[model samples]
Target: MHIRKDLSPGKQSLLTTGSFLIPLFLWTIVSYAPFIWHPDIKLQVSADRSGVTTVFTAGDRVSKEFFPTFSEAIRVENQAIMEAREQNKPIIGSRRDNLKKLRHLAPLAVANGWLEVKEQQNDEKLYGVWKGLAEGSLKSTEVELTEENIEVIRSNWRLLSAYAPTYDSKRYPTEAMLKLIPQGVSSNPVYLPAPHEVIQAGWRDFTTKPDNDMPTMWERYRHSLTIIFWGFTYSCLLGIPLAILCGSLDFFSKLHEPFIDFFRYMPAPTFSVLFVAFLGTSDAPKIMLVFVGTFFQLVLVIANTTRLLEKSLLEAAQTLGANRRQLLKRVIVPGILPNLYNDLRILLGWSWTWLVIAELIGEKTGLTGFIDTQGTRYNFDRVFPVIILIGFTGFFTDRFFHGLRDLLFPWTEEAQTGAKGPITRFILRMSNHSSYADRTKA
Candidate 1:
């Protein structure tokens, strides 16, 4: 709790864990609690809009205001069909359409334990479910079917039965069918899917093979990591020596600093078009954009860190009759290793921030490509996994590098500062005292 002080490791780890957990805890509450910030309804069962190509399947969420409107639209259609039948004029639809219509209740049947997940589109199984429900042989307890829906099911079952006494896709009725009314539970907006939902989505995406020629989730992930690795690697290759030379010599500093300072302000994305034209639309442009975003800042920050090295240390090296090359190679480079390592670690993360922007430049690729496409399509649940993956990759990469610093530069203040908790110190003290007592008795 003291100013400019590290917490005991135990407390620090606990608080670090809490930092992530607290946000997740809040999200879960907002998602699950109906009276909380559930401004939308996540569909448990869903239906199609007439003449609309956008099919909202089960698990799609709609705003609460829109849910009733959506459900009512289906009801109106069913009601019209009902009136048509009573008047001895059946509104016959395409047999294919009727077949698709019956399968719309598959989600409802699945939810009510009347249909297995794999059997959702199984029209034969679904037809039997409708018969059972209409005849009262099966019932829905988990999610009670609305009274209106029960009527629709019975009416639809009668038409379907007379068309064919049992399940027969070929002989299924062409008479217009009832659409399942959209049903859902309270939920947060699509942008903030629940934790289990995110997990399920992540698992599905990572495990499932994507359609078309698109790369799998893990392939996209590896591509993203490769981009980061190369971009950061190229920057370090070129920037470090220049930065070191600039920090150690005023001549090099005056030569490079002015142009770089101005160039850094130009913003990396502005050159996206230029890069694409010069490099063509491939990974080359994307890699360059990431490099451009990170390189200028890398030079400036490392130069400053290099300059922060102790003047006394340099003076001692010079007083020992070391020449300029000796001071540059042996003193300055060796002296700044700890700080330089930290600077590179931070710049590595900076490159990640530019990944999405870089991916957008020409042809979208990598995890950013998937994220951009999904985001544009408003599939935020699918998008969350990639975003979370990027965040975790950067976090763990930084932590891994930070841990390495302790072993690599044990002389540094940060490495030496593994503070002990009070309980840990107390236990050690008692153990030492017991050892001393035993020694005295001996």
Candidate 2:
């Protein structure tokens, strides 16, 4: 309640928790509460259209405006099949295709607790699900089947049962089965998947082996980290020394600042093709882009921090007969190191801002690449998890570094006023005064 004052640690932690929970609470309300802005129907059961190759399974979302049209499309296809059956000229069905349709219910069965996740492809297990539903043995608690869909379930079960008491893929009937009616509950648009839905999707995608020889999510995550590591490390290698020289000497400052100032104004992305042409499409260009995105501003900021060293510190060193080398080594370097650490930490986050653009420069790779691919396909559920991964990665990284700052620079105003974490206390105990077992110098 005090003005311009830091709150207690308990209050700070409470506020931090509330910051995240507030948004999550609003999201849950939007996603779950019936009277909220849920304008779409998230499918709990889905089916294939006769000629459409794009098979929508359970968990797909469609706008309320469009759901009726989607339902009618499948309804028309089913009526045509029934008429064909009545005329004793049933459409010639591929046994494999009809068997595939029965397995299509696998997702709904899993959702309804009628089958296990792995049982989706277990044609026999899924057949049992169909029989249970048809005979009113398995209840659809989470997602009730529409009256039309229940009838389709019974009708399909008849064809399946007549073929055999249990599933036999080779013995599947050659008669076309009716598509289940699409049924769903109200939901937000695709971009705003429910929290539970996101959690389920993230778990499934992360654990399941990716198809098409692409990298796993963790692989992509590591690749991103690698690019960031090299880029920031290289930036430090060159930028830090240049920044130190520029800050400590007028000659170095005049030599470098104007050109660096001019180059930074040109957007870093404009050099994308140039970096690719010079380095070729791979990690090299991506690393270079992150470097470019970070390096110039890094030089300017650290140089300014260097200049901010108190004049009395440098004047006193000179008066003590310390030469230029001694002044830089003893006075200027130590004077700026704390602030420099903070500058580098801030710039590291700036480098991450370039990650998405950097990854897009060449052959797209890393988490950003996965996000680009999934986003373009409108698989926002999958995209959300990756995005959340990136955010968590960055947020916690900054937090970890911030935590270390107090331990690393205990003489600074922040460290002097702030509380030390257990890791900090343990590290100080190990390094500073600990000698005899369980005792240290006062």
Candidate 3:
């Protein structure tokens, strides 16, 4: 088997930068020109609700007055219904008033190009029985417009709300338009908001915006980071020692290999319920989940890395009057340090994956929990930012650790070209200076 050396520094940087920037460019184009895959304009209808649910599109410029009009209309309608009940009068007058307000607002919105009406037969009200197919026949009660069906309908509404905005705008859309007046149709129409709108909603929902009772994004992230750190800590504590033992002793490798492989194949989520049952829905189970995800995998990786150390090096250390302990520490462990650091860096990412599931067990605190809640509410704008935050955080963290590895282990072949780069050297110099200053003060 031929081993490939690291790419030249210039080639590596070019490839890495291109890999990210090219996709980013394409994504931006897709976001602006969403019509390539899906329609540029779509009206999502909530089957249970009446009227136009939401306007979904990119590049729309909605007038500033649209939201105030929508709000005023809703307010007037609610107030009228309340007064009608108090006065023991029919709601016909209130209904007429609501209609009049909408009648006035609709044309203004349409004329301003904020709303577009797509003609539909019977006004796009979906009322067919959707049956599931089983054994080449339609199941009579596959699904219908029951409470369950209502949920399904809502899910469709949410799906559109979430999907459209993701590719709608490279930046954010400012359209605040209303469409398909719901006077005779339904109570609430689902609308695909612009990216900016979603981001603002996410900020409010995930931050300390006074009215928001949920934990801030920072709080959730801190909780998640805490879980990942502790889990990784435990995994490193147990895994490194076990791996060293396994690598040093053939018997230990044979003894634990099958067991490690067995659990490695077992998905981490399978143990979620068991972990919750044992540890309760607190942070303990989540931390355990991360530990389980990282530990066995790390042990195997470290063991393999340690096993690859040169036998001649070990023999030389032994010949130099080193004991078994010194040979293990000074030879085996040090030999694998660079690769081991890289392994831990990669495993830290897995810890994040497990973190998502772990946070779900108890009160939703992390970015994942925020996503779940916002997604259900069809507030996809909020969801996208948190998702982006995760990826963005992971990307930078990976780069930081990658650079740190080169800085710490300059002798490693992989570190040679990467560390010699101007950017890496600058960062390395800053880091070395910081360390030196700290030592001098101490």
How would you encode candidate 3's per-residue C-alpha lDDT over 305-421 as one tens digit per residue? Answer: 889889999999988999989998889988989988988899988888988887787666677887888788766667777887888888778877877777678688766543354
lDDT of each: 0.85, 0.86, 0.61
On lDDT, the stronger of 2 and 3 is 2
Which candidate should be chosen as best, given lDDT against the real structure?
Answer: 2
Backbone clash total for model 2 is 0
Q: Ranking by lDDT, best first? A: 2, 1, 3
The TM-scores, one per candidate, come to 0.84, 0.80, 0.63
TM-score of 2: 0.80
Taking every candidate in turn, the Cα RMSD to the unseen true structure, in Å, is: 5.5, 4.5, 16.8
Q: List, residue by residue over 366-395, the lDDT tens digit for candidate 1.
A: 998998898998888889988989888888
Model 3's TM-score against the true structure: 0.63
- Regions of candidate 3 where Cα sits further than 4 Å from its true position: 1-18, 38-210, 419-423, 431-442
By TM-score rank, best first, the candidates go: 1, 2, 3
lDDT of 1 at 320: 100
TM-score of 1: 0.84
